[model samples]
Target: MTPLAGIKVLDLTRVLAGPYCTALLADLGADVIKLEPPRGDDYRHIGPFQQGESALFTLNNRGKKSISLNLKSPEGLALAQEIAAGCDVVVENFRPGVAEKIGLGADVLRKAKPGLIYCSVSGFGQTGPFRDLPAYDLVVQAMSGLMAATGEAGGAPLKTGESVADLVGGLFGSWAIMAALVQKARTGQGATLDVAMYDALYSMLTTSHALHFYADKTPERVGNRHPLSTPFGCFETADGQVVIAVLTPAQFARLSTLIGQPGLPDETRFATDEARTENEPELRSLIEDWSKGLNTEAAMVALAEAQLPSAPIWGIAQASDSAHARARGLVQMLPHGVLGQAPVVPQPVQFDGVKLMTYSPAPGLGADAAEILQAFCSVDAARFEDLKKAGVVA
Candidate 1:
């Protein structure tokens, strides 16, 4: 059986952060009921559609049942409350106080279902000065100093290629929910969790932030190189770019030998990690001079043979179609309704020495509404039809 087999999650979230968190729960075998708006999640309109289905939506929202509802309606709100009352967890990403204003807040639902794990994912958390401010992933990234710490030195601060701010929030939200679930199992009591994109991104600045207080040094963007580690950055070879991380003295010694610079390490400038970091420009130029003669593959293999951590920089298509990705089943062709078989990245975790089994595709915009209302809210065919007629449920 799956780890979360019997857990049921009432998901009242749209877009990235909250939906991604619930998707993780659903992947672990939680019966996630996605309570979408009547118009569907905003991600449906995002570009790069397949057979009229949003690729972004499908990638993040697999393995969940959809039930669209007009939460503005009293009847719809009441039905949502009923679902929350019976669910093991309730996840929402509405701005702070919006859930409470609509009567679906954690306080009300956790009181009704005493053991429920209620998770709120927001840009600034539920009780912060910026709680009520409207924010997207970009805003949070900039505010949390993540964007400021990216890009090349003296270059314009660049946001990450992916929506790291949103993903971080979702990851932390799932982790917090899982912890709360564990606590509930132990004490038979519920817990409320607040996951913020700003906080999540800030917490992930482990090295950069730690340096500020510990050494009175503010982090600056240094492109692909690590903040402190020497010889830990991308290098260009004859064919393409490769990354080599000589993280320890042993690795550094091995790298020097592999690059035909054995005597260089004995120099004071490149002897230790601290000295090498202080002289990274000269070190990087020296390594690149050697790499310029060898192709990327050859350089990578030589580095690997020397026991240094190194790899060629691969584009998304290359990485996705690589042998290792296929061997590990990192990507799969899943049936996403009219989209047919589409490639999706499933949950990366392994349970009991085996990969978690994947479930069904994301529901086609409330495709399970009638079934869900009938099953949970006890709205039979005629009542469900009436609610649909009244535009209460879609």
Candidate 2:
């Protein structure tokens, strides 16, 4: 509902992590100005294009004004500092020290505006030994043990289907910025946030933490199943796979009845979660015998009728195009000249049964430069023309 209506965010970052955080702020009604080089963000040229507009870029940059500025120029740097002086927050995802080298470091900006919230997104944190090492989603996921804990037990480690590390970093970045804003509101003091992809992704592996921290063991790659629970994985049906999520004894009992073995849970080997996990193979065999005879829908229906939790695995397209997604307003269309309408996928938090916010289409490169410059920097038409002519701005 435009909670951050008057807040200003200067998005100096590009690619996924920085864009994602700024996108969230923009969706929540912050006036986000995405500053890019004259050539624009690399994502703007990346593939999966629709009518020559990069879908990847359009999806994350919605509702933000774009300003193409040449930060390498001395005048451009001064303008960036000036624009940032008027903003509430500035977020960057450059390598740890690059912002300082480029003359827009936290100290410089905080001195210019004491209450400014500066966020830096990186592969590793600013103080860590690995902070100097370059990293990507794949690197973080693999190093943080998320990839190691994924996939089938005997198979090689695997990365998630999506860029989870990057997304997780962005998520924490947004959370930290909001938290800093809250603190600033109370104390009139700014914060310098250091959000790392490695830390964020590693923190998200709760199950991995459970095994490594409590049990002194590495979490095994358990594939689609809940690692410690039996009968909590995908079961094959005649048509496709159905997910079974029987966790508690009550759910397990219902599952037992659904599989035509009501007393199975009472058996010594299957009486407790630990016992059932120790004998998972036998339990899986029994569950499949019942499920394999039915189609996925049939199995799902039968499980539902028995009050057991079950679901069917759907591809991305199938899930996104489902009735539930449409009904919940999970996908909203934003008008775009190139694509006619580009889908804006926002967080799925419902406020009083309504979507949190709606965004306009992502701006074209430097599309809002003049408006943003006039509004924030008080740059007149002549000065704006001079800057553009000097290649200081585009």
Candidate 3:
């Protein structure tokens, strides 16, 4: 049987983070029922459309069912509560107090279903000073000190190219949900997870945090270079940039040999890791002087022959289309009704030699409303239609 095959999730999240968490669960064989409002998830309106539908929504929300409900109505709330009672997990990413205001708070849901795992993915948390502050990926990236430590020297601090804060929050939420599920199985108890994007992103800045805590050193924007390790960053080659990471003394020796500077590793200024780090500017210059004579691919090949670590910096399309990525089943094309086929980056995990893959596309807005209500709520067809007419269920 697939992992989490029998587990059910009530997904009440709209945008990236919370939806991504539930999407991971769905890929793991959970029955994730995405509960949207009458108008559907806000992500569906985002740009980069695929055959008139949102590509962002489809990519993040696959292998799940969608149900639309008018939660502001009393009847709608009753139906939601009823559905929650039957679900194993309920996830939301509303602002701090919005869930409570809508009467769909963790406390309310867990009270009705004692074994339910209630997960709240928020900007800050439920009870912090900044809990109510508006937050997006950029806000968290800035507040978490990620941006402050991410750019080229002397340049303004830059946010990462992707929504790393949101992605990190989702990753942590998925882990927390699984851990809570395991605990529930052991103790017959549920859990309330307060996964804040700010906290999650902060926790991921391990090197920066370590430097600050151990040495009272704030990390600067060193671009692609390692803060402590010399010769462990990208360097320019004739064709393009290539990353050369020489962390060990042996690797440094090999790097010197590859760059045709055989005596450089023995020099006092570049002998040890610390000494080399201090003289990194000179080291980079000497290495790049040789590397600039070779194309990125040739430099990479030469480094590989010397048994040193190096790779050409790849753009998104290049990385996605790489043979290694295809061999690992990292790239997949899933069928979508609107686009016929949609490219999906699946969960990067394998269990017992089996990669987890889910092909179902993101559902249409309220597409499975009647079927879901029939199965979960046990509402007959006539009553299901009436709920639609009453504007309670869409």
lDDT of 2 at 343: 86
lDDT of 3: 0.90
RMSD to the hidden true structure, all candidates = 1.2, 1.0, 1.0
TM-scores for all candidates: the values are 0.97, 0.98, 0.98
- Model 2 misplaced stretches (Cα beyond 4 Å): none
Tens digit per residue, CA lDDT, model 2, 39-142: 99999999898889998899888888999989899989988899999999999999999999999999999998989999999999888789998888899988
Look at candidate 3 and give me any clashing residue pairs. Answer: none
- Between which residue pairs do clashes occur in model 1? none
In candidate 1, residue 44 scores what lDDT?
Answer: 82
Alpha-carbon error at 332 in model 1, in Å?
Answer: 1.7
Off by over 4 Å in 1: none
lDDT of 1: 0.88
lDDT of 1 by residue, 1-394 (tens): 5888889899988899998998888878899999998789899889688778898898888998999999899999999999888788999999899999999998888778878889999999988689888989999988988888889989999999899889889999989988988998889989889998999999989887788878899898999999899999999889889999888888888888877889877999999898999999999999999998999889988887887888888789999999988888888777766877877787887777676745688788889988888888888899888998999987
lDDT of 3 at 67: 89
